[model samples]
Target: MEAPPVIAVVGPTGSGKSDLAVSLALELDGEVINADSMQFYRGMDIGTAKITEAERRGVPHHLLDILDVTEEASVSDFQQQARALIADIHGRGKRAILAGGSGLYVRAALDVLEFPGTDPQIRRRLEAELEAAGPAPLRQRLEAVDPVSAGRLGDARRIIRALEVFELTGRTFSSFMPAREYYQPAVQIGLDVDRELLRERLARRVHAMVDRGLLEEARRLDAAGLRKGRTAPRALGYAQFLKVLDGTASVAEAAEETVVATRQFARRQLTWFRADPRVSWLDWQDPGLVARATGLCRTVPVQPLA
Candidate 1:
């Protein structure tokens, strides 16, 4: 009669969290709720490394392929949807496994975090500033207002959002860091790999994606309005390949850039997850990882709904 605890599998992009989530799901009688923002788009499979049906191993996955390339993904919207799905999954007496490398999305799903509302006019104005002046000045403004978020945010889109949050809420975005409390009973399992080894693996993975027609995929999506997509077009592999199609880079150049970018992104993912003391880390290559994670899940204290 007790409610089940939520288990989150989080880590760097290439750390095999999805496979491990499937293993844990099989062991714990759970379904996966994707926390990867990029994987939400239907046609972004190859670039996002979305799991194939065969790879899902019969464990139901949620929140994936639910968006089109044209529609922007909002973490606030996702937070609402994911919490409801977790409640539904729990109501059905199955544990919910939150899986993905996107740190904010993972936190939004399980942590006691609240999203601030956005103002369209303010957003348009900031975006205009970004277009007129580029990201450096906006980043400088963010550094003046919200240095912590400015330090962490590397892209123009996110930098603009942070500034917008400060302007709209009159509070710095980083000041809203979620307390260690969970919205529901939850546990986080983090996966890790050695830096040099992970770099090699990521490079190989990018090459493999190119071999699997990443260029072709990007081209198809491009003709389908990828350029107009505020978010989807800026995703990792998609952005690089867009350069290839633009004649600004070669396919090989794009692949190499993707490898480098993904490696840096993996490091950022590690830093973000490692900051939270609640996450228990395991080596991705551990042979007994599933059993270990199963034990951890069983022992984690279940907090009543908050």
Candidate 2:
């Protein structure tokens, strides 16, 4: 028998992707591999809306809570880990369901993507330049050589990495972007939602998280050196609540800020997934969402293992 195609449940945050993925896993005899970058950190449950053990419904989950809050989240590392899990699941004659909203990480695992090699020396020099001069000068330099990357990237770290790639490979970073072609036979099911409803839902969810002790969680993680981390400290709720930890903001203010940031993040996620024509979008609130997603998974084109 041919192997089952990998199933990816994708969409904006709080769009029911996780629940749908869990249902699909149960229906399709699959295990889930997380693609949500924020969920990878230990003790980040409430802020990240991580699925609880009871919510997992006996389905196996991979790659959650695998990183310390102090470590950087690496897309390349996830690419390797997720691919290996998919292969192992396939070898056991089970389906591999990739679930989450991290667009680049999802693409890194499923698409025909290559991670460019990095040079530490080149990166250090760029970082030094970034420290001496702000990102404006480096941004201008990147714009001259790779305008696409410059326009797409907002943060100094990503900008520095793009410049490092250019210096190391003499090629534009955008040139390495993956085409939509799948690395393996796969199907992506995107959960679509009403924007206004989702925005409200996000706000409510943020408030619920705060009620569930997001501020306390943030305090615990902050004591664990969350502020020292490059990535974890910047996650939506955690970042805002850290202000609460230092007395710079009230819990109410942090909760409001987290809601705004999460809503904005969801918008970006929607924009990212919507750009991929390969994804089969389903109404997030559809009563039969699992059935529809399962049907889509069943029809995935057959291809040999990579």
Candidate 3:
């Protein structure tokens, strides 16, 4: 029998991607592989909205809580791990459901994306420069050599990475960008959301997170070295709540800030996934959303892998 095509449920945070992934997994005899970078860390449950054990309804989930709060989540490493899990699931005659909203990580798992090589020495030097002089100098330098990447990249870490790639390969980072080609037989289902409703939903969700002890979780992880983590510390709710711990922000203030940041992040997520023409979008709130998504999975023909 032919293996089932991988089904990826994707969208902005709070769009109900996780719930739909579980429903599809149950209906299709599939297991889920999380692609959300923030969900990689252990002890980040409340803020990340990680699906609880009971919520999973006995369907197996992979790649959740696989890293300590202090460990960095690497896209290349995730590419290897997610791909291996997909192959293993298929070999066992089960479908592979890739689920999450992390755009680059999703592309890494299913798209023909090539990650640039990194030199630690060069990276460290660049990081040091970033720390000493801030992003202004680094952004200026990147704009000089790789204006496309410079214009696109806004974070310090990515800017440093682009510079490192340039130094190592003597090629602009943009030159290494992959076309929207899938690495395997797969289907991407995006949850289409109403921007206004999602904004309100995100605000309520952030408040609910706070009521559910997001501050306590953040404090626990902070003591567990979340502050030392390169990526984990920057997560929306945790970052805002961490400020509450430091006496710089109140619980209400943190919750409000988190809501704003989350809404902004969701907009960016929509932009990223919408740019990829291959994704089939479905209304997140439709009564037959699961049925529609499952039909998409069954009907889409998977091309032969090259």
The top-ranked prediction according to lDDT is 2
Model 3 lowest lDDT segment of ten: 297-306
Clashes of each: 0, 0, 0
**Model 2 lDDT per residue over 1-306, tens place:** 457788999999999888998999999889999999999999999989999999999999999999999999999999999999999998888999999999999999999999998788999999999999989999999999999999999999999999999999999999999568888889999998999999999999999998899988988998999999989998999988888878899988988888888999999999999999999999998888888888999997756655
lDDT of 2 at 282: 92
Evaluated against the true structure, the overall lDDT of model 1 is: 0.90
Residue 251 in model 2: lDDT: 87
What is the per-residue lDDT of model 3 for residues 11-69, given as tens digits with 9 covering 90 to 100?
99999988999999999999999999999989899999999999899999999999998
Candidate 2 local distance difference test against the native: 0.92
Using TM-score as the yardstick, the better of models 1 and 3 is: 3
Cα-based lDDT for every prediction: 0.90, 0.92, 0.91
As for lDDT, the candidate ahead, 2 or 3, is 2
TM-score of 2: 0.97
Better TM-score candidate (1, 2)? 2
**Preferred candidate (lDDT higher): 1 or 2:** 2
Q: In candidate 2, where is summed lDDT lowest over 10 consecutive residues?
A: 297-306
